[model samples]
Target: MSKVFRSLLLITALSSVSQWAQAGNYWKATAKDGWLDGYVEATLLLNGNLDATSIDTDVDNGVVTLRGKVETDTDKALVQELVLGVDGVNGIENMLTVFSPGENEDSAIQRKLTDKKVATVVKTRLLVAPDIGSTKIDVNSSQGVVVLEGQVKNDAEKQRAVEIAKKITDVEQVVNKLTVSD
Candidate 1:
């Protein structure tokens, strides 16, 4: 065989091998993604707390994307947590919106009323506490989460404000954004 012919044949063989390896890798990635998609879907469906019928799961490489609407913020977070627990999931794109079908105008008004009541109770407690400077602290509540924003005389006062908010009835969580001015 001519030297030039041999060189051409060798190049062709290397190219074919390279293409085969690339194709194999592509298929492997695709298969893995498919498996992950099914696994994620099954996980969501198995969770009794989640209504996964409206949710869509898409997996590419090792990343999973969850798109759809959840009943509440808690459900949205839960979905992300559940998908992230999957063995091969590198990351999650949670595009879930919170849309509660059962929450009518009355329910929304009730939630707002509860939040307002929580805030009022917390503020009253802070104001009555002699040791803390309550005037400088601002309290806000939403969906049972109380947020304390503003400045305090010291760390002790800040701690006291947080404790007061936490003790309030219907306050699910307290977020302290109080800065110590003293």
Candidate 2:
């Protein structure tokens, strides 16, 4: 074969190999990386207070992070433990806080969701709500009740937020601290 024909054939072979390798990587990311989502969801769902809807999980190299809203200080503490307890979770950031509008990430909200007896009930109902999700909003629980704090777009969102928090099975009451913007 002439030199030019030989060079062209070599490039074609290499390109095919590269394409195959790229396809394999896509599958790996989908299958291998899927566990992180499941791990985070499982940990929250196990708690009566949290469900899959209110949280989002992302993993990098077996390190998992959970971001979302729960209904109390105790819930926050519980989540930190749950995420950390999972098989591969190395570092967990407790972004979930007790509901406080002015309160920074650390401020505590006094409500039942933080309370040991009823947090599960409060969290479950919130998870069921049409408006809230596993990630958006924040929940605080104290003494078996619930406190909700976060920014929503409108009054409907605010009311929906309150409604969801109140619906949890064990929630004795709901303290809606949600803020709405026009």
- Residues 1-182 of candidate 1: C-alpha lDDT, one tens digit per residue: 69999999999999999999999999999999999899889877876556889999999889998898977654665677567656789999888888864355477875775666567667756866777975988889999899999988898999989987887667899999999885
Q: Write the per-residue lDDT of candidate 2 for residues 1-182, one digit (tens) a residue.
A: 68989899999999999999999987787666577768567757776545446767777666666677655455666566556545556676556645643334343443423464344434444555456543456776665567777777778877876776664434678887778754
Candidate 1 residue pairs that clash: none
**Mind sharing the TM-score for model 1?**
0.55
| Each model's backbone clash number | 0, 25
Candidate 1 ranges beyond 4 A from true positions: 101-182
Worst 10 residues of 2 by lDDT: 105-114
The segments of candidate 2 whose C-alpha lies over 4 angstroms from its true place after superposition are 49-53, 100-182
